[model samples]
Target chain A: MGVRIQMPLSLRERIGMEEMVEVEGDTVGRCLEDLTRKWPELKGELLDPNGRLLLRWTIYLNGRPPSSSEELEQYVSEGDIITLLPLVDGG
Target chain B: MEREIPGGYNGRILRVDLSRERIDQVDLDASLCRRLLGGAGFIAYFLLKELPQGTDPFGPENKLVFASGPLTGIPLGGCARHTVGAKSPLTGGIAKSEAGESWGPQLKRAGFDALIVEGRAHRPVYLWIHDGDAEIRDASSLWGKETRETQEKIREEVGEARASLAMIGPGGENLVRYACIMHGCFDAAGRGGLGAVMGSKNLKAVAVRGDRMPPLKDPQAVKRMAAWLKDHMDLVKAFSDYGTGSPMPRFEQVGNLPVRNFRDGGFPQVERITPQTIKGTIRVGMKGCFACPVQCKKEVEFREPYHVDRIYGGPEYETLAALGSACGIDDLKAISKGSERCNAYSIDTISTGMSIAFAMECFENGLLTLEDTGGLELRFGNAEAMLEMIERIARREGLGALLAEGTVRAAQRIGKGTEAYAMHVKGQELPMHEPRLSKALGLGYMVNPHGADHMDSMIDLFFSAFTAQPTVAVPDLIPLGMEPAPLDDIGPRKVALFKAFQAKRIVADSLVLCHFLPYSFSQVAEITSAVTGWETTPMEQIRVSERILTLCRLFNLREGITDEADRLPERFFYPTQDGPLAHRSLSPDEMERAKRYYYRLLGWDDRGVPTPERLEELGISELEG
Candidate 1:
């Protein structure tokens, strides 16, 4: 399945300047794993020491956040679009 | 009290009774100092006890507290910050806004940890402080003057070119509900109508110049700490390079930036107002607060239709979002001019922009006619109209008077479903951040005593990092019995994290530290202990923060800001029209549950009111309204 993954400019600059990429995965986790495999530089930035999805990199699947029950283990469908947003700190 | 107790504090508070034209110095007890710390802590305690319940916010009964913290004036980065607090005329609740500039440190060096002004003066006046001494001078000549001219006049008259002044302008004098107090020319206690409280007291300005250096517990240790922090200068270089503007492009990318009065999730013209564009266009240089190495203040010199004064400083992220994208105006020059006018007139740029955006929406809906807008276009993306509205609001001309009333009250006056379009919480206009993108911030906005303040709690973005990255926040979270929760979850775990960070933010504000400063909880505790010799710990400081927060909540409850009033506008619960959050709106039931969970953690009842046991635990006295 082709899942469209969108990256923020901050991450896009570090990941070969591609605005969006298509990766194969049936679940959100696998999709992210595929993304990191494609752009190895994103591995450290998008995951914790435990190798779990980084919380700060907000992921919107199809223009909406995953429901609480799903979290990162949420299932994905073909043509699903996921946006990776960097952490924005406030004053 | 011992003659000169500790390193961090001056051990005295200057109390000014403007009505009697009397000045008195009161000793700050060590116990109180240890308990409340300073800044927002002191203000909350004082306001809760002294301000009578239901007292008119603009009356003499409402007191204004200008306080500095233990860390202030200690040659530490971000110590230049301080707080101005009062019973807000807009929110009708406790209002504490922190500002960064030279004024707080100067006031600290002038031998006072806090300055409390009460009672209204019979005539216009200004307070002058020089090296622990104080005097009241007639400000009749300085009345109605802009902040820049007032600061200039005060400096010249006081014969101290280095004097730091906090003054108000026509907006304040006219009692604009969201008026701010300008520090020197640019920095401001810009939320909650504090300037109006100053105007109500008939006080025009506060000028201070002090030569006495603050006594530190271990001068060598303080210097060593400063050096250590400065060694990591690269951490803040981006801030130094672009000020708060460094975060704009990132915020835009995240859909956190409020666009087109929050109807849209993204602004296509964001590239025009990014830090790079600002630096390339008119940025002359950068400025810094006292003893700060970051120098995150950008200076812009303008020409032609938007001849912004360099002294008034350049637009930061909030200004850029509020005046630039929020209004759907892509013209950076117009935003710059609007920002300059806001500074010059001593009004809040956030409130002003939000008010204009609300009016523009009304115009779009045909609720407002050309007759109402005085023939101005009053349309979204109309840069000229935006600039014109800023000036008009400052002068209270035509539609300006209604706009100056703020979005909440303005909507009431311009009824016909306009309230539905007014984007505000408890009458104070929302800042640049979008709630749908950051759930925790939205919750903070609803429950914050000051109403819709981003600084009241740690934003969700940081929490997201804490969950995923687990680096900086892990150590801080250890003491609070928390680990990061999932970003989309608003369950008990996330609520706990929110409460912990809220406590930390309270400590930051009370310490008078800048939000931009990267001070870990442990580091803050270490610095406080090193300066005050009080053996402060992170856990103990957090307890104090909890107490401070409870006191503020008590004040709010007493002032009639009930649970019903603690809510986001209808618009926030509606999905955005575009971008990542195109079909996303904060779920009201989930938000309510989050609020309830947070309250429960604080030992408050279901109504969000502090219980008797909670008050006893926090050492807060309940004031019966």
Candidate 2:
């Protein structure tokens, strides 16, 4: 079973121009790890040096975000959807 | 023979006394240019020097200054910017706003670094400036016209098909306190009621056309920088592709988007009104300002439901949130139509949307009635009512008349508990940003001279997380010694960071650079040096920016806007009903401490007044009123 990861257009060019990709994992962190492993360049964009998700970018499991940082380790299921979005300052 | 001016300057300041129907030109002072640079700096200096204390904002004594910086018209990515300043009718303080397009560059090409207008005109008129001369022409026939027709008629009368113009609409003519001066079709000096000042002068437009470009000291260096920015298009591809509203969903996720008049925590229909949705639906094309490759401006056209003119341009993130989720209206077309109306009528979208939202909240809470709204159901999510209210406000009719006074005054006149719903600071309505999400930004909303402006400081979210081992998304800020901090931190460290970022933003405004561009402070200094042949550095620019800010503060203080007015509305002190920030709230004591700390950091006293020694150190002690 696999989860679908959606990327914003701003980072698409860095990840071979794909808008969404599917990866297999049991956890949100594992899914991101697999996705970043496939596109090594995205590792820096999605994670900080401590391997935590960058605060500037928010990860949503389905339509809502994870409640806290530890929620990254929360279990996922088949057909779960994850989305990445950047929190820019102004217009 | 003309006197020698420095490189990147035409060395002329055009002065016009509309009451006397006189026009004259003064030589730009090189020393003043060195000290203040231009744009916001020049505006601050002139307003502080010439404006008498307690001058009525709409009176003939109020002066309007339009200024361009040393970098203006330099054919760079974000150099086509300028500032307009006057005593604000809304906030009753120093009003300074910036706009970018071809107008500032055109003014530079027309052989003037700045244009100052004073006194009221006896009749309707417009200024026609071309090449190296300017003349006042009759605009009597163009009175009561909307912005598009006004621009077209002025261009035809001036006989310059491609001339750039800055003008106002019926909103200004009727003296709406928040009227904005629209530049070109879409770009606006869109805050602080500068347009009403122009209208008060009975001036309709200032149109300019010229072929001359300012001479740069190092054209090659400027070209190299421009090329470098173009080469780095990937850094701003999202903005280039989708414009500013592309991050609407993300803003909602982080509790940044103002929902349901800033009372609600979330909008389930946020995705329906974003720029991406507009691009897929009503957007016709994308455009950019002079010499800019980012092309963040959006163009939209539609004929169904309601016809939205492409000439008025499209709404950005502020407009989307202000007129959309803030009012609980997710219909993108209605919001687009509302944006068009604002651009056409020369009303400020932020204030106008916010005023309507305030009215909606009042109506929903039983503070206002159907009769009060002239038979319209002024409820949240009522798109038609929102649109109707915009027109009425522009015309100053019915409930629009009250809203046109802005929320603070409207709440006062309503005589109900509606004051709590008026989300404003120092009489100016808040922008679309929610302070509960970013605490430092909330502090900025309090202390900003013009009132609740989003662009006054760097947003806290940018500094909330590091993108790499040692830097945030804005790595340019690293040289300024800014380290990553949490979004909710408003400690001394955060206050210091805020001051540095505020100084940098003020420098950009004074330099008249675009905030959206990711230029480093060193890059900005290098460009300034290359253009003006001055040995500039990042620290020097920061000092100059600080000086400009202090001058603005002095102007505000002289006008009676003291430190007591530096506070957010009570709504911000409480948490939203639901959302990511539902459990979060701003403490008044903490914010008070942060403000005082910020003041002390800027060398100001506890009351937020600049010390005499600090003024002397900045070399502006004599200008103190």
Candidate 3:
């Protein structure tokens, strides 16, 4: 089993309109790297030049943010869900 | 007449005294425009100057000002907006709310910067305004009509098929305390019970028609701004594509969405009602206001479970959260139907949904009984009961009569320790944003003059370390010297940032600009200069915004809404039951300290009153006398 990466509708266009994609990785960073490798165009959309998650996006591991000090290095198990959602400003 | 008035102005204010059946034109003062700008600024000035202290909000003495700014009718995107202000029947304080559509621009084009409505009409009446003229016509036939029907009938009667209307529905006619003024069929000045004030006057609607555009000082500059917005549509693609409720799941993840009367933090079912789901299931089209290119306004239609018309528009983020997650109902169709009913009846979705949520919680806790809800199970996740409650609230029937007064008063009337469940600040029901996740916003909820307004201040998450980057910096706050602060910081630095952001927000309201648009302060200053030919700057606009806010504070204080009323609800001071912010809660002491610091930053004394010295600095010291 692999980790399923869920993307918000705002970013689905870059990934051929797929709401969620599955990839194999043990860490959040590796999963995102695999996601970018598959889509190619999502690298700039999801990450900055420093290879960090863009400020506009938040990552949730199974509906909650990872509790580790290093969010990108948080370990994941098989069949875990990684969701990326854009930051909403106002009501 | 054109030469005497400044550019972007008609140099006229329509004054309608319904009591006397008298109509008069008051010349717009150039000085007032220079000092207070317009919209919220004009409302603050007129309400304070004319309204007596302790006047009953629904009494004949209360006044309603519908105002547009210099930027209105200038062919710019996001400029088709207006502010409606009065003494709120809901909060009993300064009431100001803004709406976007064609009505504000039509009002400006009809040869007035603002319309001041006062006194109760002897009978139901609707004002028909055309190019540089006005008439009050009998609206007895239109008294109990819904918003869409009223619009159609008024347009037919006036023989102006294109005339824009601002009208009320049964919710207003019945004087539900949270009734909103519906503009067009979709847009609403949806806070502070301004519609109840309209209802009290026996006024049904105001129909405006005109082709006369206010001459711009630099037409090319205005055109360039419009073109710039058109060219940069990519900047707002998400809004254009999915509209406001597109980020529901994100809001849930961050613990910002109000769940189950703000008692819980997690609503895993939020994905069911997001804009994407709506688009996939029921959305028919996307529309825009006046010259706006973004077209963020959503139009939805469905006939399966409930017949929801597109004319009433679809639910935005606030509506979705208030009616969906807050009530613990994930039935998207029911939520959409509730939204449609609110638009039809002209009640505020936020307050209506929140009131229902409060009642549901109270009922669950045994404070209310089946007998109290008239045999209805007023419980959370009871979508049928929630839908029925919306209708009941609008018509002020049975339990709705208590809820019609809004949660603060309703809890008092219930009197079974239900006050703790009433999540509100002052008398206004809190919007969907959770203050625990964004501490500065919590402080904003406490100290905002009108009470619990999310639009008046910046959300802390936007400025938190998670999202603070040079590329994604908020254009408006950067010019005001704002920097990133921790999301939970309710200290001096956060208060300072809140003060600056509040000033910018007030400027947007004064200009009647749409908050969704990404306009920098300098860009706004440039637009103002282009329209009015004034040598304006960002700092000058900030100062003017401060003046308007101070004036609103004075009006509220004069009406006995003191600094003591500046506080959050009890729910926010405690942690949510679960979610990302399950362990988080706002410290009451820190909030109090932050509020004091904010007062000092705004040059207000410890009592939250603008000091005489500060009033002098703002150039409104004469009002203090």
TM-score of candidate 2 against the unseen true structure: 0.91
Chain A TM-score per model, please list them.
0.85, 0.87, 0.87
- When 1 and 2 are scored with DockQ, the better candidate is 2
Where model 1 places Cα greater than 4 Å from the true spot, the runs are: A1-44, A47-88, B1-5, B462-475, B622-625
Candidate 2 chain B weakest ten by summed lDDT: B465-474
Estimate, for each residue in B1-625, the C-alpha lDDT of model 3 and write its tens digit. Answer: 1235667888899999999999999888878887888999999999998998898988999999999988876788889999999999999999999998899999998899999999999999999999999999999999999999999999999999999999999999999999999998889999999999999999999999888888889989988888877865545666777788555666787788899999998988887888878887899999989988879988999998889999998998899989999999999999999999999999999999999999999999999999999999999999999999998999999999999999999999999789999888879999988899878889889988887999997677654333233222343576567764444577776777788788878988988898887677788888999988888998998899889989998998888888889998877878999997889998888888998888888889998989988998988887762
Note the DockQ of each predicted structure.
0.11, 0.20, 0.11
Please give the RMSD to the true structure for each candidate, in Å: 7.4, 4.8, 5.8
Name the docking class for model 1: incorrect
lDDT of 1 at B516: 67
Report the lDDT tens digits of candidate 1 across residue range B1-625. Answer: 3344577888889999998899999998766677788999999988988998888989998899999988877888988988999999888899989888899999998999999999999988999998999999999998889998999998999999999998999889889889999997889899999998999999999998887767778777777778877865544555766677555554665677898888888776787886668888889999989999989887888787757899999888889889889999888888888888899999999999999999998999899999999999899999999989988898889999999889989888999999998888888899888888777778888888899888775566544443243332333566557776666566777778777777777887888787666666787888888888878788898789878878888889887788887789988888888875788888899989988888888888999888888877876655423
Sliding window of 10 residues with minimal summed lDDT for model 1 chain B: B466-475
lDDT of 1 at B137: 92
Error of 3 at A22 (Å): 20
TM-scores of the candidates in the order shown:
0.88, 0.91, 0.90
Best by TM-score: 2
